[model samples]
Target: MAHLPHGRKLNFAAGPSALPLDVLQKAQSEMLNFNGTGISVMEMSHRSADFTEILTQAINNLQDLLDIPSNYKVLFVQGGGTGQFAAVAMNLMRLKPNHSADYFVTGTWSQKAAKEAEKYGKVNYVLPHTKQFKGVPHVNHWNLDNDASYIYYCANETVHGVEFQEPPSHNPDIPIVADMSSNILSKELDISKYGVIYFGAQKNVGPAGVTVVIIREDLLGRAMPSTPAVLDYKILAANNSLYNTPPCYGIYMCGLVFEWLKTHGGIETTAEKSNLKSSALYDIIDNSNEFYHCAVDKEHRSRMNVTFRIGGSNGNENLEKKFLEEAQNLHMIQLKGHRSVGGIRASLYNAVPVEHALKLADFMKDFQRRFGEPEA
Candidate 1:
């Protein structure tokens, strides 16, 4: 807590998560005058040379971090990941007339994407879920349509704390679309594997009001007749993501965050640190015996969102409430699980340091010793 600047709590919210303190401090310093422009970033015109340079550098920095190929165009758009759900189907579905694109539904977000896509064109359910949305099922069990326009899946399901280590294999002709809203930049990835990767800026990037979309060149220019001009990727790409007013402030803050990542050795080192942080937290839950259980299968567990619940004989709502209260008292906030899936969730985002995660793990171990295995 003492190390945290501005007395900020250890935030673990799902989206709109934490941003690096250095980035915030820089933003604060530039709040009144950004780069001698004598105007706040929020007040600047998106067409101004200063803002354009910022946008250009941001894209280049991101491309460097993710090793994005020259063919991929990075656009900062509005409407977040949810907007892309419709945009993707409307644009990519034009590749084949009326072909049903496959969707691998793993959690709440994925299911929503599938439903939205149905409005644009036919949709294929690839690995359907029954009871709970936990770990991802095997690809062998998936019923994929090779002739479909493209295959869609959420790279990280924030609600259920499920994640796919990489994009799924599909017909070579069909592109793979991924919603990486929650886990983007938390680690290294094969950007080339996905034809389109979209994520809301609020999570690991910067703030809300902006969605970053990376689309391969080959996948552009195929939008359906009904696709809106604002939602069309090719149009946005042609304009270098400055098609309209745009989320100017969000893009500015995101540029700062991207610069911050590049200074820290990019995603390669970040992934190493993330692995350690997630491992420390997972170890506590695994060693708790009957005291706790993570619903997600081990292999597909998310390095960003760790979901679990108390499971001992003493486990109940009252104890869980007590746990949340105690966590807050200790300056750890937003540790409660999502309302949809009641339990506990600790979102280990890129900005969350490893020491904080270790502190939470220590607290969990202490809690188990006090209330769970008191007899021992």
Candidate 2:
């Protein structure tokens, strides 16, 4: 096994998940004196020249990685995805006097986003008749109001382990906004397709403090009078996300991650790595002969977080507990699913190495051999 700090265990927990070992090491090396400034990034002033350069380079690196349009302003704000849930509505509701927002509720996060938006304006579910968040259906089947302020959806549903296989069909005039908290930087994206893309840094980007918001030029200056300046896209963009003291340390660490990504061949290569890692576990599930079950519809399975239950009849909780306990004993920790829903969820973010996935897959195969009901 590759040596790790704290003799690190393979982390599979979703959000605040795994970061690249190299990134962590680099952070360690620089924690004491960031670029010869002799102060930890945490101690640096947000308004200082060194930090300004760091912020600028971070933005530049992100623009190059995501192909953010020149007309779009990338702002690093203080809140997480939940914060953007409100900010998206507050900023976009002013698009018209009769403003309304439509949300595609494919999973828990998007559902929460849609609910939070109701506080700012009228919110409608694009697929209210849907029974479950297993997968997305035909986008054309959605009852979309073309003149709506913004059509919102989560690019990846972290909880349900579903992802948009393709961008949803939408009216060209009405902008599409995405909460890409889990899937951002996982793969190449068409930046032009969305008027806005925002993600909390904890998942794939960096740590949890900073939220990156990419807003199209035209979407700015539309914040309602009651909108808090910190939450207003235009105001934050105008002040360069400096309306108040931003997450200095978070931004610095995230910048290091961006640099790591670039050095590791950008998002395309990183995504390839992610895809391979997920398949290592998924292939085991697929071949497990009713011993394992993936609740997500196959077509919509996420490349980041792989969720599954175990056993034949109704999955044996005893077996599940045994699996978790044994896996932890192997130093592969945090394999438990979210409390809201119970099952196993292995988040294979950009930083999780393929070797770790293989080790977990091997462990899973052994568990099934020992505990799985014998084949007929």
Candidate 3:
């Protein structure tokens, strides 16, 4: 309901996505003088009490939102999601020597994670895409190594628009590690199912620079000796994610975003809203039949990133281009698809209202009316 300064159009970029309006205003109002400290959050020292209080509240809010049990420790660290690829590998590889790790390759991000883990230990890759990245591979066919260290998976693939509606069930002894970079905090998930869950705040949380890691306490202190102190989870968790200089400003903004989530009725409410938005958009895609085709399988379509193409059989070269141009002219920005996949992608994050999705559906219908085959 609130409007941006000078009435700017809504934003729908994948990461560094739109934030709650009130949260932005609160941050702006406090930018010059935080809590009467007469200094910006950016200027405060990480060791100061003011900043410490901010960090504590932020972690508590995160724990509360995720319903993380006492067995799990919430960590706020730097290096974004990509950094965690190496961090998870370095820490978990401390398992007994000769143990291999299993990874389910759903999309580009998961593939990158598996590749990173191979540098440390034997990595068993499952469900690879030799042709083009599509839906998640059937988990029933996944070959599991009983002696593996752990299993890693990316719950949602932002680039390829693939998502796993349900978590994979694996051997109880083999821990599960997840990269929820694009869809963290957007839905309700059982925190106890995984040994480690890491996500970048830039998407669905707040801004770039900070990554949130929820790891079971038992998984700590297992880092390889060569692992750097800062990257080591044991050291960072011991110091409360301040082993060295932390991303103070980014963490503070994330705290504000957490507060916003609380006010919006927590993760369950947000998940319901997300489902509505995704369903509205996907319905339009489904009803279009041959007019618009989704590359990913129906069962594994992503709720956050709805990807579709205009031309199905005709293979019209400029159809996607026209869609982007017209959508932009109508003030629907950032609807262009990723360079890797040539089609339009609508990223509906937490901050995006259902009305935006409706507007998008309407536009897609009108666009189809113009370019699609005549209705029977």
Candidate 4:
């Protein structure tokens, strides 16, 4: 097994995933005295001018990277994607008199979001729930509610390795809400297509603890009567995400990540790299002569999380175990799949280089050569 530079291993964890080395190094250097303030960002006050600058720059960089519209407000709030599941319901359920919303359940994450939304209003499943979420149901088959407050769906399902090929088609009058937690910066998106776009920073953004909400100007001030001040988009946007002291260090780290992406040729370049990396890995899985299998549909496969199995669909437990062990031995760590659906998941986020992906593909080929048998 070849060693990576600085003795670091390739990490493919789904969330809290790999960050740019340059960002980490920069953070390390600034750990003691950030911007000559004589205190670390973690130790600084949220209201301080220095921290304010960090927050502002992060918002600006992200806006530029995603081409966020001038009408949208970029807010940094506490709580991960799970919190937004409820928040989405709490805030948007009041948009219409019926107090209902349409949810397109694709996989684990979206299903969970829909379940949470049920607590606050009438939840309509646009597509019937299936035992196995292998692909997105056709838009034409969706049972959309014309009077629903908003349309909700996860941009990518991390655990199931399923992703939407594009935004779902819906009524022009109704707004769309997307939870882009796993694939936020991995590709370019049309910000104007949705009324609300929120994501946790842990995946392709920055780190955990900070969630970024990009909400259209019109969507504000619609929170339910029970909505907390902290969770209210109107309040957060009004305060510029400074409501009740935000996640200081997490926001700072996200700012650094945005800067790193900008210097590395922006979102378009990252999108191309993401496609190439996922395609190489998928090619290996597809051409593995039944030695490997990806259950996801060809069109809806996730670029960030590539989930597959060893020894075919049923999956040989022993071979799968051995593959993970050997891959770890080769300094490739966090290759294990999610607990709910056990197999192997290689999360090739923006930070994961194409070369590393190719290396993983090569390793997969060699593993099959050693362990696989010719089909009868």
Which stretch of 10 consecutive residues in model 4 shows the poorest summed lDDT?
133-142
Error of 4 at 171 (Å): 0.6
Clashing residue pairs in candidate 3 are none
Put down candidate 3 lDDT per residue, 157-215, tens digits, no spaces: 98879998877878988799999988888888899999999999987888899999999
lDDT of 1 by residue, 54-117 (tens): 8998899989889999999999999988899999998898787656799999999999999999
Q: If scored against the real structure, what TM-score would every candidate get? A: 0.97, 0.97, 0.96, 0.98
Q: C-alpha displacement of 273 in model 1, angstroms?
A: 1.2
Clashes of each: 0, 0, 0, 0
Best by TM-score: 4
Model 1, residue 75: C-alpha shift (Å): 0.4
Error of 2 at 115 (Å): 0.5
Residue pairs in candidate 1 whose N, alpha carbon or C atoms collide under 3 angstroms = none
> Which residues of candidate 2, in runs, are more than 4 Å off?
1-6
For candidate 3, the 10 contiguous residues with the lowest summed lDDT are: 1-10
Write down the lDDT of every candidate, Cα atoms only. Answer: 0.88, 0.88, 0.86, 0.92
- Please state the error at residue 81 of candidate 3 in Å: 1.0
Q: Report the C-alpha lDDT of model 2 over 97-210, residue by residue, as the tens digit.
A: 777988899999998998899998888788856546788877666878776888999999888799987778888888999999988898989999889999999999898889
